[model samples]
Target chain A: MTQTNQPEINVQEKRPLDTGTAESTSSEPRFSPQVDIWENDRGLTVVADMPGVNADGLSIDLNDNVLTIHGRIEAQNPGKKVLTQEFEVGDYYRQFKLSEDIDKEAIAATIKDGVLAVSLPKMAPAQPRKITVVQA
Target chain B: MAFLPFFGRNFSGSFWELEKMRSHMDHVYNALADGFNQIRRNYTGVFPLVNISEDEDNLFLTAELPGLTADRLEISIKGETLTLKGAKTQDNAGDETLNYHRRERQAGSFSRSLTLPVKVKSEDVGAVFKNGILTVTLPKATEARAHQITVQAQ
Candidate 1:
C-alpha cells in the first residue's frame, strides 16, 4: 500500500465580489459580513454572521473558482416615528476564492439562525489515507 | 431633507445627476459607519450592537446576536434600566483531536445594561427572538406616556 500526501491547503484572497462600478442611487446599503473560516483534513468550512437574513433572502454561488455569498435583509423599519436607531438595515455581501484542491462539485452550504456555514470538501486524493507498514 | 429636490429631478437633465447619485450613495454608506461610531461612543462595553426606538406607548430595543438561542439568554428590567445577559458557546468543541487552520469566532458570556429614556411598565415588557435578533418591547409607564394636547380659541 502507498500513501498520498495532499498538497498544502491554502485559502486565498477573501474580498468583496466585484459586481460593477456603475453605481445607482439605491437607499439600501450593502455591508461586508464578518466570517470565520476553519479547515481540517477533510476540507474547509466557512461561517458568516448575517443577522436578519432569512433562507429566502440568501444566495450562494460558486463560479470560476470564486464563491459568492449574498444576503438581503428585509427592512424592519416600522411606520412609527424612529426616535433612535443605532444600526442600519442593509444587505450582506462577501466572496472567497477557492483553490483547485477543493472539490467545487461537492460544496454544500447551510444556514441556521442567520448564520451561514459553507463546507468545501476536498478531492478524493486529498483525503488522508492510512497505509500499513510491512515487517522488516 | 434638502436632497429630496435633487431626487425629484428628471434623470436625463444632465450628467451631473449620475454624480449626484454616486455622492448620495457615499453619504448613505458613511451614515451607516457614523451610526456605529455613535453607538460606540454611548456604550463603552457591549458585545452586540443595539438600537432603541420609541413610540407613544412602547419603547423598542433590538439587538443582533447571531447563533445565540433564546434559551441561553436572560432579560430583565429594573426601574428605568434594561439588562441583557447571555453566554455564547463555540460550536464543534466536542472534537478534541481535530486540527484547525483558523479560528476567529469568539465565544463567552456577556452582560449589558442600558438606561431607558422614559420610565416603563416592567410588568408588561415583552420580548421576541427571531433570526438571531432580539426585540424587546417595554410599555411606557402611565405617567410617562405621551399625551395629546388641544388648543381652544376664546
Candidate 2:
C-alpha cells in the first residue's frame, strides 16, 4: 500500500458564532444528531448533523465493530450570573453496527461545526478483483 | 438564544445580581433565541475555507429547511441584509408515543439572516428548496467576481 496520511479527527471551530442556535424539549433526548451515509471509492462517508456539540465534550469509540458516540451538554442554569452566552451544550448518545467488510483499523473521523464525518475503508474482500480459473 | 452546549460558562452568578432583578430582563433576550440547555461535547461537520480551496467562485449556502414548501421559503436582500424566513409545521401531526420517547428535531417556524461577505448581484439571486434543503445562488457583482487582466508592454 502506498504511504499516505491516515485520516485524523479534528474539531473545527464555528464562525460568526451566530449560527450558534439549538433548542431541546424537557422530555426528549437533547442534542441528538441525524446521520446520513454515503459510499465512495475508498470507503463509506458518514455525515451526521449535530448542532451545538463542541471539541472538548465529544467522545467517539469503536468496540467489536460497534461504534458509539457520546457527549455531554451542561444544562442551562436560570436566574442571573450569565453575561452573553453562545454555544450549544448537551449530552449525546448514538451507536451504529459497522459492517464486517470495513477495515476498522483504518477508519478516520472528524467533527466540526456540529457535523461528524466518519470514513470507513473497506477490507480486501470488499474490493473487486479479477478471477483466475483453470480447466480441470 | 442560549446555545445548549454554551450555557456552562453562564452558570456562575451572585444572589445580588438576581435579587436586584436586572437579570430577569436579560432572560427574555435569551428566550427569544430558544435557550440551549444541557450542553456537551458534540461531533459536527468541519469544512474550512482555506487559501488552497479552488471553488471560491461558487458560494454554497445550505439552509436546513425541514417542512417549509417552496412558496413559503423566501430569500430576499434589502441593502446588505439577506433574510430567509419559512415555517415547517404539520397539523396535529406527530405520534404521541414518539414524542414521549425522544424528540430532538426542531420543527416550527424559522427565520435566519445572513450577511454576505462579498457584494453580489441581489437581483440575480436564485433559490431552490428541496428535500429539506434551501440552496441559494447569488451571482457575484462585476467587481466582486474574480478576473485576471494581464498587462501588456506598450
RMSD of each predicted structure? 15.6, 19.7
Runs of candidate 1 with Cα error greater than 4 angstroms are A1-27, A126-136, B1-45, B94-102, B152-154
Q: In model 2, which regions exceed 4 Å deviation?
A: A1-136, B1-58, B90-99
Worst 10 residues of 1 chain A by lDDT: A1-10
TM-score of 2: 0.37
Docking class of 2: incorrect
Query: What is the total number of backbone clashes in candidate 2?
Result: 34
- C-alpha RMSD in Å of predicted model 1 compared with the true structure: 15.6
TM-scores, one per candidate = 0.71, 0.37
**Fnat of candidate 2:** 0.01
True interface contacts reproduced, per candidate:
0.45, 0.01
Top of the candidates by TM-score? 1
Give the chain B TM-score for each candidate. 0.68, 0.56
Cα lDDT, all candidates: 0.77, 0.52
| Model 1 C-alpha lDDT per residue in residues B64-87, reported as the tens digit of each score | 777888887899889998888777
What would the per-residue lDDT of candidate 2 be over residues B1-154, giving only the tens digit for each residue? 3453454544334444565576776677677555332122222222111111113354445543433467866667975567766554432354332212222333455444556666777888777654434556666677776798899989
